[model samples]
Target: MASRSDAEAAANAATGRPRVAVFRPDDERLESAVSLLSDLGVEPVPDPMLAVEPTGETPRENADYVVLTSKTGAELAAEAGWEPGASTVCAIGPATSASMEAVGYAVDLVPDEYTSSGLVETLESEADLDGASVEVARSDHGSPVLLDGLSAAGADVHETVLYRLVRPPESGDAVDLAASGDLDAACFTSSLTVEHFFEAATERGTTDAVAVGLDRAVVGAIGEPTRETLTAFGIDADVVASEATFDALARETVAAVDR
Candidate 1:
């Protein structure tokens, strides 16, 4: 009995294209990822692992610094008409900066590295955190490194949950494909996505099988945090994108698959 993954693998092999699993949210981000993979000449398995749930919350108006970690957060803040007011606006990466700019917001600072720790380092060097009010606006699953580091630097930090990242109900197909050894590579953009991938695999009773398959596949993580999460699951990332962006992740993963 040929499994669905077996059939899909045969079709992919016939087409001479590598199958890459992408676990972005089901929005323009996912659509853009799929298009990017197609342009990179790979067959993309568009399994949307994360779904955004807006909390209808905004950042504090009185903070001295406002930090946004993701493009979605920037868009949500703009949608809520949340202005920076007196606060200096900081973005974690170029994409978030671009998103803020798209909404006519001025991005005052962006880290050289695009991680939470990177942002913290940038802020510590660039801003006077002693007794400063900093508001971090992002998703509920945001890393504590930013808040903890800022507080340690003597900044009074507050977090506003702009949205919640929940695993979508229909996100396990890629897990099944990976378990069946149909995937050639996977691009994990966040730590949460890596965690949710295994959650799906565990639910399907294929966690070990999926892990084995992934061990044989070229895996790409968007940043150190995501790579650490994969390591916790006993999976070594074959490629960690030099840039912590999906575009870089997808390009690097596809290039690895080609090699």
Candidate 2:
């Protein structure tokens, strides 16, 4: 049986479209990514690395501020009928803010940099966090930077695990493609995605080969944290998108392949 990558490679060979790996969760995100890549004139290998498992938890309502990190978190909070009440609603980025807004939650704050550190810095500069109660609702794999930074600023921080991002069991197709040097580029949207990609490669006993193959292909990371993860794995990213959005990451990655 021919692999998906083999069929994609064969099709792309004639169209001259670059084969770019996208590791978004298997949902509307993956569909959107595939559409975007197709519009960008690339053959997107839709290999979903992350699967969202909702924790059936919501942010505490009594906090001074409520922080939501991802669109998924915001949607889940909305579905859980969690209300901000007197708390200031903060989103980690534009997408999160939009999600909150769509759910009728007023977005009180969004960091200019759209990262954990950036949100911490923004909150410190804008709000009075001294002895304030802050509730952070996000994924289980969230960075500790936000909590640490908020605590250091004298805020009592509490975290609610809204979801767990686990790697899908059958997510190593892109790893096989990468190991065979068949991919033209890859867009890594998060640090976990990078870690999961390597985990898949390692599981297939193709870690070294995948690394070597990646050396020949363009690699793009969504932000500094993701790039740092790739660096930890000894994988040098050819492009680090200026913005942390998937749109930015995909565009930058596809452009790198064109170059």
Candidate 3:
């Protein structure tokens, strides 16, 4: 395994093209960012700012409801062997529900608000959690929001770290896109993506067209976490949906740009 300190150096050396910035660096997200950029004819210089890696550990025993919030959770559950019937499955939104369903698990409920608050509300409103055992599947880099909420609502709540999100190596061509000023708008799906965008943006020293493009060009995030990332960068998010689904994200983008 390459050392963390030098990973960026190697990645930069390998980066032959000047990329536009994208937040969060991981295999699945990276692919999605590129696909969107290509579809838009933006041809982004691909660089991720955050790296979320799965731990692959199963949830605590007696897990009766498995909670999936991000694609990371879904991907981890895909290989972590948490069976559906073992617990009533809950997804934060439809895209997650679809991912879970594609993996053969039937989702029990999805929130209407599509944020962490929304998930809690959905569970409280629809689920008879008077004595249910629940486990939230997620990366290490999360808050205690879900667990606290579920526990407060009389559900036996357990939390498991299915992955870890770390900052991607910085200081390199990924820098060129944000710094050298040779690119257009970027895209993000998570707050991590925003982290990545700012890291490169700060390095570039000017937020002008690049930042504007991200804000103006059709910002599409999968859910609240992703949208918050865009907002944190001091760029106004043009599209904010009530749900957390790629369908919503994609459809919102097409509408934002078309209008």
Candidate 4:
């Protein structure tokens, strides 16, 4: 079977499809980006620069509540047979909430902004976390925003590293397209994707070439964190989604490239 990029290229050859580099891990998660990009008439090229490895750890047994910042965290936590233990589950966004719900876990709250700060603000205003035991399920290299915020809010925060991100064996075709200037745009969903993309480019000795390609193409980020990560790599995102969702990112990427 042809690869996703090859299949999309052949299908959209006559219409001149916009090529998009999707830097997500290889899993069902990748299909979400593929479906959204295809719907927008963009050719999404898989650039699985990062792979997720589960840590096989269960959640804390005696927590009053649980917090998850990403869909992956929610999925892994459910898979690990984590008992919520009367904890009111809180997620960062609709996607994360939906993931938890699919695995028979109920999400009690989701922030308005779909971010750490947003979750913190909501908890501060709507919930009484004072003296509550909150368990945070996240990746090994996860951000400290949620942890610090919960601690400050008087919640006894316990952390469980449910998974880890590792660089993929190959960078796929993204670097090639970026170097040749064929990639029309790129969507970065996480800070890790930006870091791994640059790492992959550097490994292939195409950092400078990839930088030029990124400059030529319209770059779209899912949120502020991803945009800041891109900026750290000297590639400013041309468009950032108002909402931190793949659906929003797809629409913003198309709009950015159209302009």
Q: What value does the lDDT take at residue 58 in candidate 4?
A: 68
lDDT of 4 by residue, 50-147 (tens): 78888888678768888887778877777777768677888889988988888888889999998888898998898888998888888887778888
Q: Could you tell me the C-alpha RMSD of candidate 2 in Å?
A: 2.0
**Would you list the C-alpha lDDT of every candidate in the order shown?**
0.91, 0.90, 0.63, 0.84
Using all chains and alpha carbons, the TM-scores for the candidates as numbered come to 0.94, 0.96, 0.70, 0.92
Clashing pairs in 2: none
Name the weakest run of 10 consecutive residues (lDDT summed) in model 3: 171-180
lDDT of 1 by residue, 1-259 (tens): 1123767756776996888999888888888999999999998888898999999999889899999988899889989998898889999999999999999899999999988899999999988999999999999999988999999999999999999999988788779878998889999999999999999999999999999999989999998989999999999999999999999999999999999
| Steric clash pairs (candidate 3) | 19-45, 20-45, 23-193, 24-193, 64-87, 179-204
Candidate 1, lDDT over the whole model:
0.91
Model 4 residue 95 lDDT?
A: 89
Per-residue error for 196 in candidate 1, Å, reads 0.7
> Model 2, range 157-229, lDDT digits (tens) per residue?
9999999999988888779889998888999999999999999988899999999989999999998889999
> Which is better, 2 or 3, measured by lDDT?
2
Q: Tens-digit lDDT track for model 3 on 95-192?
A: 67877777767788887776667788888887777788888877776656677888888988778888888766652344454444443334455666
| Model 1 Cα RMSD, 1 decimal | 2.9
Model 4 stretches astray by more than 4 angstroms = 1-15
Clashing pairs in 1: none
